[model samples]
Target chain A: MKFDDKIPIYYQIKNYIYRQIIVGELAPGDKLPAVRQLAVNLTVNVNTVQRALGELISEKIIEPQRGKGNFVTEDQGTIEKLKKLLITQQLQELYENLHQLNVTDTEIVSYLQDYIAKRKQVQ
Target chain B: MTNTIEIKNLNYRKNYRSILEDVNLTIESGKTVGLLGENGAGKTTLMRLIAGVAKGASGKITVANQDGVPEKKSVISFSEQLNGFSSNMRIDKIIRFYEDVYPDFSTKKYNEMAGFLQIDEGLRLSALSRGMKEKLVIGLTLSRDTKVYLLDEPFGGIDSMTRKKIIQSIIKWKSDDAVILVSDHYVSEIASILDEVVIIKDRTIYTQKSAEEIRSKYAEGIEQYYESIYEGNDIDD
Candidate 1:
C-alpha cells in the first residue's frame, strides 16, 4: 500500500501484487490485506486501495468474498496463462517501440536477448 | 442507489447580490468529492441548499432524491463548520443520540473509533478542546454508515499532528459505496485525499477536475493553481 506520486496508485498496487505473485512471495490462496488496513498502512485513500483490489478481482487474479475478504486465486494454470499473456503484451509493446525507432530485425533480436539476459542476471 | 445531492441551474441571491448563479452540480453514487472555496465564496450556501436549511432561493436541490430535500435525514449527514454542537452534551450522550437517530448507526464502531482516536468517552463536550471536538465530529459522522457525508472545514482550527490524525480517521471510516463531500479553505492539507477538486468562485462553479489533472494542466500545486485563478480575476486596481 506504499504510495508513490510518480505513478497512478492503482497501477502501482497492481504491479506490486503481480510482482509478489511472480516471485512466489504471495502464494496462491493467500489472503491479502484488507482495503482499510492497507490504506491506513500506506497513508492513502481507501478508495485508491479499493480500486486496485477491484481491478485485481476483475482480472480473476483475486477473488473477493463478502464479509470474508479478498483471496489470491488458487488456479496455478490460469496464473501461468495470465503471466504468458502479460509477457506477450509487454513484448509486443517493446517490439512496436523498437520498430518505430527503425531498428533492424537482427539488431532488435540481439538487443532483446541481451536485455533479457541482464534482467535475469539482476533477478 | 438514490442521488445523494443534485443541484440544477441553481441561482441564489441575497438582497439583489448574487451568491451563486447557474450552479449545476451533483454528488452521485460512490466518490468522495472535495468542495474547495475561499471565504465568502458560497460553499456554505450550497451546503445549506442541499440540506434544506435555506429557502426562497431559486434552485432545485434533491438530497437522496427526496421530494424537496427532506429535513436532513439519516441518509445525508451534514457536519457544519463549528456549529450544531452543544457544550452541555456529554460524549456518551451524543453517541446515544446518533445511535437512536441513524438506523444504520453502529455504536460498536463508534466506540472503537473513539478508542482509537483516544477520545475520553466520559468527558463533556465543553471539557474537550477544539481539536478533540473535531475528532469527535469525525468519529460520530463516520459511524453512521450513511449514503452522503458532507463535512465543512473538517481540518480547520486544529494542529498539524491532529489534522493528520483526522485525515487518517476519515480515510479509515469511508466505504467504497459512500459519497463524502468535504469543504475546506485548507486545501493543501486534504489535497492528497481529494479525488476531485471543485472550486466555487464569484457565484459560479469556476473549475472542477481531478487534482492530478489540475496540477499537470496548471504546472503547479493545487494551492498555487487556486491562487493564480483568483489573483488574475481579483484585479480591482
Candidate 2:
C-alpha cells in the first residue's frame, strides 16, 4: 500500500485496490486477502483494512459473502465507472494546473503522448 | 490458537534484591492493554521477560499456549524503554536492519508509514528531534506485524501532536488477534484506548482486569483504580 502524507490512508488503500482492478491484476471474481491477512501483510491496522474493504464494497468494486470472504465484483462496467471517476478528478486538477500555466489542449496532448510513451517503455 | 498471554510464578532477583516477585497474569489477545505503574515498578522488566530479552528470569509466560509458556519471539514485540538505535546509523539503515531481523517486516509497509509520518528519508537518526526520533522508532517497531506488541512509555517526552500521531499509528498497527501492551504513566491519555488495565506495584503484578471490569468492580476510572491500588486499598472496593 502506497500511502500519501497529504491524503487519508483509507482513500489511498481504496485507490490502490481500484488501480489493481483497472490494471487487470485483480481479476473479476477474485477474492482479496482476508482483512486480518491484509493487515498483517501491509502492517496497517485491521480496522484500516476493514474500512478500505467496506468502502470498496460500497463502491461495488468488491462484494462480501457472509461467513465467506470479499470477492471482486464480476461487473467490468462498474470497474470502468470507477476508473472514469478517478480520471475525472485527475482531469479537473490537471485542467486547473494547465490553465494556470497557460498550456493549450494541443500542447497538453503532445506532452501526454510523450509521458505515455515513457511510462509504456518502463512497464 | 487463540491469542492469549499468561504468566505464572514469574520472579526476578538481582543482587539478592527482588526486582520482580511472584506474579501471575493473563491478557487475552486482540485487545489493547495498558500497563500502568510509577517508575521502578518493573514494567520494563516484565515486558523484557515476556519478550525473552532477559535470560535469568524464572517463570512461565505463555501466549496462546495451553502449557502457559511463550515461545521464543512468538508472543511479543518488546520495545525497549531506552532508545536502542545506533547513533551513527541512518534512519533508513535502521529500518533495513529491523527488516532483516523480523521475518514479518515489510518494505512496502515501511515506505507507506514513512509517507504517512512525513519523515525525511535521507536524514540520519541523530539529526531528528527527540519526538521525531521516537516516532521513527515506533514506526519501525509497529511495522513488524507481530502478534504481541509491547510499547514502553511511548508517549514520554513527546508533544501532544506527536502523541496523537503515535496513537493513530498504534490503532492502525493493531490486528484483531493481536495483543498490544502499552506502558505509560499518562493514564488519562491511554485510558480511553485500553481494553484492559494492568497495574504493577512493588515489582509484582498488583491488579489486572478489563477497563470496564475494573471500573465496574471499583466504581472508579483507571486513574483512581491505580491510586487505590498504590494506596493499599482493596481493588474490589
Candidate 3:
C-alpha cells in the first residue's frame, strides 16, 4: 500500500488493515499474513509492522492464537462498532473541512444529502 | 556484546586529500540504516571503513564492541567488491567457493536466492548485466551470516525490476539481530525499507533520524527532507 508520508507509518499500516476488514476483503476469522510477510509486501520496516499489529490485537480488531497467525475478529458486534468508528473518523474530517469553509452543521447535513442524491440521480 | 557499531573520531585520507574527518556515529543492530549523500560525500569511504576493507586515519571503528581490525572483517559482508573471484567463474562455482571460504555462508540460502532472483547457475559474471551483477552481489553478501551488511549503491546502474527483486531478497534474508547499511543517492527507491537515515554532507555525518520521525516531523518523505536540506529550507515541507 502507498502511504501518506504526513502520517506515522504504523498508523497508516493500522488503517490499511482496518480498511481490509471494513471492506470485507478480510472476513471474520480470516487469517492475516505473517508479520514479516506483511512487512515485506508493504515495504515497511518490521518493527513498524509489529507495532501496527500490536495495536490491532489490543483493539480486538485482529486476534492472535498460539502458534497460528493473526486473524480477523470473529465477533460481529465488535466488527460493526469498528466500522462505525472508522466512518465517524472520516465524517469528522469532512465536517472539519466544511466548518473551515464557514459551513454550519445543518448546512453540512443538507449539502451532503443533496450531493449524494444528485450523485445517485447521475447514476 | 553491544549489538551496535560505534565510529569514534574516524578519519580517512587518500593521496594527501582528506575524504572523511572526525566522523562519529552509532548504529544499533536490527536497523536498516541508509547512508544518504551526494556523490563525493565519502559515503563509500565510510562503508569501506566500517567493513574494515580500508583503514581510517587516527580513529577507531568498533562493530559489536570490537575495533576495526583485519580479523574483524568476518563480521561484515560487503555487496560491492567480489575481490578474489575471477571474471569467468560461473555462478555455481562462485557459490561453492564462498561456501568453502566463509564458514558462515549458507549454500541452501544461496540456492533459494538464486532461484528467486532468476540467476542461472551456469551464467558467468562477465556475461551478466549490471542489474544481474548487483543481484549476484546481494545474494553472495547476504548468504554470509555477518553482524553488518554494507550495500554501497546496490541499486546504482541497474534496472527497476532487478532493484525490486534485490529489495525483496534483502527483506527476506536480513537477520533480525544484525544490521544492514545501504548507501544510495536515490532516497525514494530505498526509503520504504529504511528504519533510520544518516545524512552525510561535506565529508561527515550531518544528521541522523528515524524515517518515521522525518515523516512526522517534516510532514514529508525522506526524499523531500533531503531536498529541503539542499534548498536551505529545512523542515518547511
Candidate 4:
C-alpha cells in the first residue's frame, strides 16, 4: 500500500485493489473492509479512500450493500474484462518504454518471440 | 457543501509585529487539512484565531455555521497546552475537568482514545513525558464532539510509534461533517493523511490545494511542493 508520491493516491488505491482481484487474492463477492479499516491499513486520508471506493462503485467493480460494507462484484464477465484491461495497460506501458528505446513494432514482435523462447529454455 | 470553517480578511498584530495579515481560507467538512509553514510563519496564530483563544485578531472567522462568538467556540476544539494545567493533576482529573466544562466532551471516546494511546489514568501531568503529554492533549482534544479540530504541531519531536498511533486515532474518530486542521512542521509524516494542504508564507495564506491534485498535477508530494515553493518555484495549482 506504499503509494508513489507522483500519482493520485486514490487512483493508486484503486489499482491496488484491482491487482488483488486479478491475482485472485480478493475473490469476487468478498466484502471489503470498512472504509475506516482500509484507511488505517493504508495510512491514507479517509476521503481518499472514499474516492477510490466511489470510483469502483461507479465502475461496477464493487457495489455497496445497504447497512453493510462494500463487496467485489460477483459478475465473472466483469472480472474477466478487468483482467484483460490490466494486461493491456501493462503491455501499453512496456510498449511505450520500448518505443522510447527506439524499438519498432517488428522489433517488439521479435523480442516477444525471443522472450518466449528464453522462458521455455528455463522450463 | 458549505465550508465548516471560514476565515476572511483576518489580521493579527502582536507587539507591533504582524503575525498574520489578510488571511482568507475556507475549509469544507469531511476534510483533513495540513497547515504547513516554516518557523514564525503564523501557523499557530491562525489556529488560535480559529479557536478564539488569542486576542487582538481582527477579521471574520466562523465555525460550524456560526460566527466567531464564544458560543461558536463550542464547536471548535483546539489542542490544549497541557502546561497550563497544574503539574500535580492526574490524567483522570484532567479528563474530568474537560468533561465537566465542555458539554460536548465524550467520556467514552476519551476512554477509548486513552486506551489506544496507553496513557495511564494515574500519571501526573508533571511526570508525563513530552510524548505522553502530547498523547494526553490529543486524547483531550479529540474527546470533544466538535465540528472543527485544530491541532498545532501534535507530531513535533514525537516518536514514530506514537505518531502512528495518533494518526490512527484521527482516521478512526474523524466525522463526515467535521474538519480536522493539523498544523505541523513535519511534512512527510502527515502528507499521506491530508486531504488538502494550506500553505502559509510571508504573513498570508499562500495557497490551498487538494493533496491528490498536487500529486497528479505536479508529480510531486506535498513535502516536495512545500520545498519547491520555498525555493521560489511556481506551482499554479
Candidate 5:
C-alpha cells in the first residue's frame, strides 16, 4: 500500500477500497476490516482511514450495521454505478491529457481503437 | 479533562544561549503529529519542554489540562527516559522498573509489543544493537497508557524494514483519544502516518499544516516542501 505523497491520502485510501470492491476481492455484503486494522495495514493515520470510510458511508458504497461494523453495499445497482464512475474518471483523465497534446476528438477515438487492438493482440 | 497539549509563549535558554524562542503550539487529541526539523533545530528541546523534563522556561505548558510539571510528567511518555537506565540492566528489569515507577505502564502492552518487535526480554541492554535498542525504546514508550507520547527520532539509523515494522506497530497500538508527537528530520518514511506536520526553523515554529493540506495545496511531498523552505537560507549544516 505504498502511497503517492502528492495526493491526498484519504482520496488514495478511497480508491484502494474502491478497487477491491470493483475487482470483487471485497465481495458484496462482505464486512470491511475495522478502521484501526485498515490504518495498520496501510501504515496510515487512523483519522485518515475514518475520513475515507465516512465518505464511503455517505456515498452509500458502504453500510454501517450497528455493532457489526461496516459492510459492502448489497445493492448491485450501486456497485454497477460505482464501476461506471471509476471508468468515467479514468477516461476523463486520458481524454484531458490527449486534448492537451492537440489531439482532435476523431483522432482520439481512432487512437483508442488502435491502442486496444494492439493490447488485445499482445494479450 | 480533554487530552490536549497547549504551550503559551514558550522560551528556553541554556548557558546564555537560546534554544527556542517564543514557541507557541497546541496539539489536540486523537492526532499523530510530526514534529519536523533539521538536527539542532530545537526539535528535541521542544519535546523535552513538553514532557516537563527541561526547566527554566518563561512560558506556560499544560498537558491534559494540568499546568504543573509533575502532572505533565505523569501523562507524558518520553522515549529518552531510557537514558537513565544502566546498560547492564536486563530488558525484564527495565520493564519491571517502568511498571513500578509509572502507574500507567502496562506489561500486557509491553509483552505484545516486544513479541511483535522480536525483542527478547532476557537480553541485557548492552547486548542490543542500535536498531534493537530503538525498538526497545519505542516499545517501552508506547507501553504507557498516557495522554501524550513524545517519540524523538524513533526511526533514526534503523533499516527500512525495521522502520516500517515500527510504524505499523505505532499505528496498531495508538489509542484513539491520545495524541502521539513523533519528531524526525527525515519526512518521507513517516509522512503518511502524520495527521499534521509542524516544522521548526529559526528557533521557532516556522509552520504547521495538515499533511493532507500540504499535499493537496503544494502538489509535493512533505520532504520537498520542507526542502523548499530552506532553499534560500544559509543552512549551518
Candidate 6:
C-alpha cells in the first residue's frame, strides 16, 4: 500500500489493518498473516509491523495465540467500539477543518446534511 | 546473540586528507537504516570501514560482537564485492566463486533471489544492463547468510520499475534480526522501509533520527527533512 511519508509508518499500518477489519475484509476470529508476511506485503520494516501489531494486541483488538499467530478479537462489541472510534476521529478532523473556515457548529451540521443530500441525488 | 554494529571514535585519512572524523554510530538488529548524505560525504567510506575492506582508521569497529577485520568481514556482505569479479565471467560462475570464498554464501537463497529478480545466470556480466547488474549485485549481497548487509546506492541510475523490483526483493529477502544499511543520496525512494536515518555531513554524522520520529515530530517527509538540512548551504564550505 502507498503510504504518506509525513505520518508515522506504524500508525499507517495500524490504520490499514483497522480498515480491513471495519470493512469485514478480516472477520472476527480470523487469523492474521504472519508478521513477516505482513511486512513483506506492506513493503515496510518487520520491526515497524511488530510495533503496530503490539499496539493492537495491547488494545485487545487482536488476540495472540501462542505458537500459532495473531487473530482478530472475537468480541463483536470490541469491533463495534473500534468502528465508532474511527468514525469519531474522522468527524473530529472534519469539524475542526470547518471551524477553521469560520463555519459555526450549527452551520457545519447543516452544510454536511446538504452535502449528503446533494450526493444522494447524484447517486 | 543479537546481531549489531558498533563504531567508536572512527576517523579515516588518506594522504594527509581527512575523509571522515569522529564517526560514531550503533545499529541494533532488525533495523533497515538509511545512510543519507551528498556525494563524497563519506557514506561509502564509512560502509567500507564497517565491512572491513578499508583499513588505517584508528577506531574500534565491531560487527556481530566481533572486532577483528576477518571476523567482521565474514559476517558482513558489502555490495562492492562484485567489483572484484571479472566482467567476462558468467553470472553462475560468479555465484560459484562466491560460494567458494564465503562459506556463508547460500546457493539456495541465490537461486531464489535470481528467479525473483529475473536474472539470467547464463548471461555474462558484460551482457547485462545497468539495472540487471544492480539486481545481480543485490541478489549476490542478500544471498549471504550474514549478520550485516551494506548496500551502497543499489538504486542509483536505475529505472523506476527496476527500483521497485529491488525494493521488493529487499523486503522479501531480509531476514529478521539481521540489520541492512542502505546508503543513498536520494531519500524518498527508500524512506518507507527505513526504521532510522543517519545523515552524514561535513565529514561526520550530522544527525541520526528514527524515521517515525522525523515524520511525527517534523510533519515532513524524510526527503524534505534531508533537503532542509542543505537549504542555505548549497555552496560548499
Off by over 4 Å in 1: A1-7, A15-29, A54-123, B69-72, B100-105, B211-228, B231-237
Per-prediction TM-score = 0.73, 0.63, 0.93, 0.94, 0.96, 0.95
TM-score of 2: 0.63
Candidate 6 at B78: error in angstroms? 0.7
Ranking by DockQ: 5, 6, 4, 3, 1, 2
TM-score of chain A of each: 0.76, 0.82, 0.94, 0.92, 0.95, 0.97
Over B1-237, each residue of candidate 1 has an lDDT whose tens digit, in order, gives: 555677788998888888899998876676667788889899988877776666767867766657454545657777762266588878888888877777888888888888878888699989988899888888887887777888888777899888888888888877777888889877777766776778898888887777656554544566666776778753121
lDDT of 5 at B218: 76
If you assessed candidate 2 against the hidden native complex, which CAPRI class would it receive? Answer: incorrect
**Predicted candidate 2 versus true structure: per-residue lDDT over B43-111, tens digit per residue:** 888888787777587888776564323454744666772267767678777877877777887787777
Q: Each model's C-alpha lDDT?
A: 0.77, 0.76, 0.87, 0.89, 0.92, 0.92
- Best-performing candidate as measured by TM-score: 5
Candidate 3 yields a Cα-based lDDT of: 0.87
Docking level of model 4? medium
Clashes of 1: 0
Model 4 TM-score?
0.94
Tens digit per residue, CA lDDT, model 6, B1-237: 354988999999999999999999989898899999999999999999999899999988989999998888889999999999888999889988999999999999989988988998899999999999999999999999999999999999999889888998998899988899999998898998999999999899988889999898888899998898766433122
Candidate 5: which stretches are off by over 4 Å?
Answer: B1-3, B232-237
Rank all candidate structures by their lDDT, best first, as comma-separated numbers.
Answer: 5, 6, 4, 3, 1, 2
Model 1 chain B, poorest ten-residue lDDT window?
B228-237
Runs with alpha carbons beyond 4 Å of true place in candidate 6: B1-3, B232-237
Looking at candidate 6 chain B, the ten consecutive residues that score lowest on lDDT are B228-237
Rank ordering of all candidates by TM-score, starting from the highest: 5, 6, 4, 3, 1, 2
Task: State each model's C-alpha RMSD to the native.
Answer: 6.0, 14.6, 2.1, 2.0, 2.7, 2.6
Ten contiguous residues minimizing lDDT sum, candidate 3 chain A: A1-10
Per-residue CA lDDT of model 3 for A1-123, tens digit only, reads: 787765779989999999999899999999999888998898777878988999999999999999999999999999999999999999999999999999999999999999999999999
Itemize residue pairs with steric clashes in candidate 3. Answer: none
For the predicted complex of model 4, DockQ is 0.75
| Regions of model 2 farther than 4 Å from truth | A1-123, B1-3, B66-71, B216-219, B235-237
